[model samples]
Target: MKATVERATLMKSLGHVQSVVERRNTIPILSNVLIETSENGEIKLTATDLDLQIVESFAANNVETAGSITVPAHTLFDIVRKLPDGSEVQLNAADGRMAVNAGRARFSLQTLPRDDFPKIAEGDLPTSFEMPSSTLMEIIEKTRFAISSDETRYYLNGIFMHVSDDAEPTLKAAATDGHRLARYTLARPAGAEGMPDVIIPKKCVTEIHKLLGEAGDNMVRVDLSASKIRFTFAASVLTSKLIDGTFPDYNRVIPTGNDKLLTINPKAFFQGVDRVATIATERTRAVKMALEQDKITLSVTSPENGTAAEEVSGTYSNDEFEIGFNANYLKDILNEIESDTVELHLADASAPTLIREHDKSPSLYVLMPMRV
Candidate 1:
């Protein structure tokens, strides 16, 4: 393989593909990226961790020979990344070594046979749809914070996406860690009808979000089956295996009878919770919120740390009530809210609370209370 690619373009593409390669690998070829020159004289880079794969193609300045090679992903990325900006990078592969050349630096990495690189099986992605990149970004960003990290409940480790036609046709994305849940819905896009319910792994969700940030106003193409999902936008394509487990019936936990209304400024509430949480114990990170006539008192007491209390003005007309919540969990949900005011509907101190931007907004959050 022989090609000359602009340093900046190659580096940017490398950064995206190499992120899928893990730091440690049990299989030698898994640590390498496949580089190939296409018939039309474009350069393609591919990296995979068996479960997920990303392929990026870009136009290069020159292509002398058409061939393929596999080289260490991180090493190649680091070498290209260190090259001076606006420089031209020349790549040559022969004698089982791939050589990189720039202004005054040279790197030769041992290559693995291109045939040894494994590709994740993509068997007939029957369902395909297109949506604006910005819409996809919003759906991911609003709910990803609640993804579970516990390995025991493997099904909850990612965001659940499905089409809901209950009240209206919409695509809903939801995530929960058993302590808090976040759900966001948007009008279903065309061609998304009859799409299978799928759980997108957290890693794929993160990488797709990064890709969308650069996509601007472009549209993204999504193709998926019950077992795998693929995203294509710009010159990049990402394929990931879906989490093979059943997601719990999330609608059952979303309460519909919470009547006590508490309206507070989200920014003020976030700040108050953060301040009082400073003295909260590390184990629980619990903070008590006492709601009265027109004010809310945030308090925290730790055995090792001192106590803290702050009062924030709010609008509540119901009887006084107190509830305990994990400070970190509360702040995470609040960060996703973009409105000036947030409404919290409470059934009781022990029942799950419903939080939203307003009664009409499509986004909803449920946070379970903790004992302080």
Candidate 2:
């Protein structure tokens, strides 16, 4: 394959495709990106790790011949990244090697047969929808932080997304790690209703987020099946196999009747929590929240270290209550809440607290209390 492409265009597309390629792989081809030049003057880059695949194509000029080859994704990305700005990059594949040249910098990389690249066969995407990039990004941001890292309970390791077909159709994204859970809802897209819910794996969520974040003002086309999901837009496609486990019923855990409300400036509250958590131990990074009248004291005690506490001003008038929670978990929810004011609904000292935007949001957070 021989193609001359603009440095900036190739660099951007390589950056996207390379992220999907795993750094360490037992299979040789999985570590390389599939580069193919078409007769129409478009060069396509594809990378996959069997479970996830991404294909991105960009326009190129001065194509002498049409062919396909696979080269190290990261190495190629690094070459393009370091190339002089606005320079033309030439790529040629011959004799089992790929030559990359830009300006005076020249490099040759080993190539794997393009036929070795794996492809995900998504039979028929019965469910399809179109969502704004901003909305999809919000959904991922609000819930991805709570994805479980514990592999034993694999079901809790990804975001659960589904279209709620009720009186008001809505799209819901939820995630939990047993200690904390995040739920975000948005208006349902036209073609997503009645589709089977899918548990999108954590890595898939990460890659999808990276792409959408870079995509400014672009719309995403979502296609879903029982076992796989695909996001296609802007000359690129990201497809991943669904996690093979059932997500727990998230609604059952969302606390109800937690009436005691405490409203505080999220920025201030988050800052105080972060500051106090510095003195906390890794094993038990617990923070005690002592709420009474209109003030809350966030305190952390470590036997090896000393005690650190901060008094955060809040709006609470009910009976005094003290609750213990994992400091990191508390901060996780606080950071996801975008509202200026954060509302914490408490039942008592030992119940799950609901953290949400003060002005009723479709998104809500549930944090289980821990003994201080």
Candidate 3:
């Protein structure tokens, strides 16, 4: 394969592909990226770890020959990243080695046969839809933080995506780690009416977010089956296997009878919780919230670290009550709130608390209380 590509363009595409290649691989070919050239003036790079795969293509004005080869993904990415800006990179593969040259820098890397690279066979994808890249990104951002890292409950390690028609036909994305849950809803896209519920693994969700960074003003095409999902956006394609477990019925955990409401500036409330959390125990990291009419006080007491408290004024007229919650979890939920004001609906200090934007936006959060 002999092809010339711009340094910046090559570096960007390499960055996206290399991220899918694992640093430690039992199979030799899995650590390398497959590079292919075509007569249509395009260079394609593909990387995979068996479970997930990413392919990206970029225009190459100069293609002396069309061929395919595999080389160390990280090494190639490093070489392109350090190359001089605006310089063209020349790649030539032959005799089981690949030569890379740019200006005064020269490097040779061992190449593997492209036939050794594994490909995931995408069966008939009965469900397909197109949605704006911005909307898909928003869905991932709002719920990914709550995805569980616990391997025991393998089912909770991803965001659950499905279509809901209970109120208005909407697409919902939800994630939870048992202590906190986040759910975001948006109008269902045109081709998503009969889509099956799927759990998108955490790593795949992360890669999708990164790929969408360059997808300015573009729409993302999503195709899926019961076992796999694929996303296509802006000269790139990502395919991932779905997690093989059923997500719990999240609606049961979302409280419906919480009537007490407290509205406060999210920024101020987040700052207060952060300050008081400094004195919390390292094991629990608990913060105590005491709410009353027009005022709320956040306090933390640790035997080893002493005590800290901060008073934040808000619009709450309910009876005074104290609730305990994980300080980090509270701060994480607050950071995602884009609105100036946030509402927290409470039912005493023992039940799960419902939180959302003051305007009742489509996003909703449920945080379970802990003992301080």
Candidate 4:
């Protein structure tokens, strides 16, 4: 294979696919990316780690001969990345090595046979829809932070996505890591009426987020099946396996009787939580909050680090009470609320609390209180 692609174009496409290639792999081929010249005169780059895969295609003006080859992903990415931006890149594959030439620099990378590269199964995608890329990005950014990190509770290790119909149809993304839960929703697109509920793994959500960040258009197409999901936009396609577990009924965890109300500035709340958490112990990251009369106080005490307290002005008209929460959880939830004011719907000190943005963008958060 011989082709001359602009350095910037080649590097950008490589950057898009390389994230799916893991640095450490049991199989040598898994560490490499598959590159081939398509029949339509486009360069196709593919990378996968069994569960998730990404394919990106772009055009090159000069073509010598069309061929396919596999080479180390990171190594190729770095080589192209360091090359002068406007320089022309010449790629040629002969014998068992792929040669890259640009300006005065040259690189020879060992190539593996492309036949050994595993292809992800498309299966049968019965549900498909397209939505604004910005809308889809908002749903993921607002909810994915709560995805569980613990492998034991594998079900909660991804975003739970589905379509819900009440008075109006809505598409929602939800995630929880036990201490807190986040749910974000948008108006359901026209063709997503019967989409199946699926748990999309954390890694896939992450890669999709990155792709959306760089997408140049307003829309992204999503195709869903029982076991897999595919996202397509521009010349890139990402396919991933659904997490093999059922997401819990998250609606039941949202408290309805949490009537006590407290309104606070989110920026202030996030700063207060962060400042107080400094004195908190590593084991507990705990912070105590007290509501009295007209002022809200945040306090942290650690056996080894003494104690710290700060007061932040807020509006609370409920009975005076105290609540304990993981300082990190409080900060994270507050950070996600991108509004001037946030409201906390509370039942009591021991019950789960609901945090809502004053604008109420159909996103909600539930934070389970901890004993300080």
* TM-scores for every candidate against the unseen true structure: 0.99, 0.97, 0.98, 0.97
lDDT of 2 by residue, 283-323 (tens): 65999999989999999999878999999999999998789
Worst 10 residues of 3 by lDDT: 277-286
Error of 3 at 42 (Å): 0.5
lDDT comparing candidate 2 with the true structure: 0.91
lDDT of 3 by residue, 257-317 (tens): 9989999999999999999998777775989999989999999988888889899989998
The per-residue C-alpha lDDT of model 1 at residue 81 equals 86
Backbone clashes, candidate 3: 0
Model 2 regions more than 4 Å off: none
lDDT (10s digit) by residue, model 1, range 199-252: 999999989988998899999999999999999998999999999999999999
Which scores higher on lDDT, 3 or 4?
3
Error of 1 at 280 (Å): 1.8
Question: Where in model 4 is the C-alpha error above 4 Å?
Answer: none
Residue 306 error, candidate 2, Å: 0.6
Instruction: After the best TM-score superposition of candidate 2, give how far the Cα of residue 301 lies from its true spot, in angstroms.
Output: 1.0
